[model samples]
Target: MANIPAFKLNDGNEIPSFGFGVFQIPADGTTYKAVSDALKLGYRHIDTAAAYFNEQEVGKAINDSGIPRDQIWVTSKMWLQDYAYEDAKKAIDTSLNKLGLDYMDLYLLHQPYGKVDEAWRALEEAQKAGKIRSIGVSNMSPKLWKKWAPSFNVTPAVNQVEFNPYFQQQELRDVLADSHVALEAWAPLGEGNQDLFNEPVLKSLAEKYGKDVGQIILRYEHQLGVIVFPKSVHEARIKSNAEIFDFELTSDEMDALRKLDKGKGMHDPDAPGVADTLLNAFDIHAND
Candidate 1:
């Protein structure tokens, strides 16, 4: 196994450059098996959430994998319904109980809406209580981040967003850069969008590096200092996604890939004429 690089967060904690994501992993034995397999394959970082409803399975995998709790980095999130101060705290307890862990490496506000300010306060309390090591947000726009960043004594350590070559968030990235906040890519492979896999430049680069187009994209983001959580149920891809540390992309190649950014989200939060659907999409029911 190769040594994956680590990024130092503003809070002084180090995060693995790559992690395994359990976004839609069913809360069954399959989830447990997949996560355990990832750990055995040298993945120390695992990203999950209360809304995912599979934290228990993730916990079971870690406990059964024979890895020390401190040797692994576990991250989970607070859903919208649990955004109030009291609810958020309870949610953390529920998550910890579900995962059977003493603490979380990082905990994030799952979205920008609902009672986020109150939820953020809960995150602060959790940090103070040692329930979570670092605090951050997910899917928060730069506007929201600016308004919220000043309110906390502890600055955000990270911002998880949908980042891929086609949807490179340069503006948000710049804002986070100024605050020393690290960025994490959720849909790093564009949610398995086939069009991205067929891009000419990616194909060319894949051939040059003797890697798949997905590998090329992952490497590009890695060079840009964005932590990526590429989800895969397949074992081969699980290993391939982590094999990116051995090579580097040149400046010209990086620029060519950057050109693929269309400046709009492939998975837009505000899709036109779908307000109800969009709102529902981020609702708690979607997770259930």
Candidate 2:
């Protein structure tokens, strides 16, 4: 097993620096196998969510892998429909039941919308009851942070968002740094943007380091104190994504990659209509 690094959260819990995500991965056998392969490749962290609809498969893979539960880190989120106080409380239990776990290592409010205050209160209550180790929010902006920070009894341990070479999120980084909250990158590979892979700087860095463009981007973000979990169903790609800890990028090289930030991401939570679109678009609870 590779000696992967970990980042300490504000709440003092640590998360594996590199892991696997099951965002678009289907539930049927695919998520289970991908998660199993990732564990075999020494990935101790597995990121999933209620909206992803694959927690059962993830749980099955983890349970069958024979790795002790404490050796692995699992994360799930509360969906928009479950934002009410009671709904949020039940949602957490539902995730636990589906994942077949007694507790979750980390849990997040999936978005910045809905009855956020009520939902966050539920998360806090769950943490107190030992159902969740660390509680946080995803896709939150500074504005939204301000809206809820003053009222929060427990500070968010992390803020996961769409981050990549093209959208570095320097402002959010500074904000999170000030509060000692970890930043986890979701689209850390630029979601396979052709322009990003074809960029001269990234290409040159890959050549210099004898790695692929994906590796270069992931390593850059990792060096910047950002945690990343690049999702891929392919076994080879899952293995390749974990090969970043062996190399380090120098200051100038880090600066070169930092300059690629375009100051925006694919989805802007602060933007108008985004909340409505996300809140109304999906029926994640339909199959239940």
Residue-level lDDT of model 2, residues 1-288, one tens digit each, is 569999888888989988899999999899999999999999999999999999999999999999999999999999988999999999999999999999999999999898999999999999999999999999988788888766888999998899998999888888888889899999999899999999999999899999999999999999998989999999999999889988899999999888998999898889999888998988978888
Q: What is the TM-score of each candidate against the true structure?
A: 0.94, 0.98
In candidate 1, how many Å is residue 5 off? 0.8
Candidate 1 residue lDDT tens string, 1-288: 598789999989999988999999898787898898899889999999988888999999999999988889899988777787887888888889999999999999887676778888888888999999999998866777776678777788999999999899999999998889999999999987899999999999999999998899999999999999788778887888888888899999999999999887755644454434533665553543
RMSD for each of the candidates: 2.2, 0.8
Judging by lDDT against the true structure, name the best candidate.
2
Q: How many backbone clashes does every candidate have?
A: 0, 0
What TM-score quantifies how close candidate 2 is to the native fold? 0.98
The whole-model lDDT of each prediction reads 0.87, 0.92
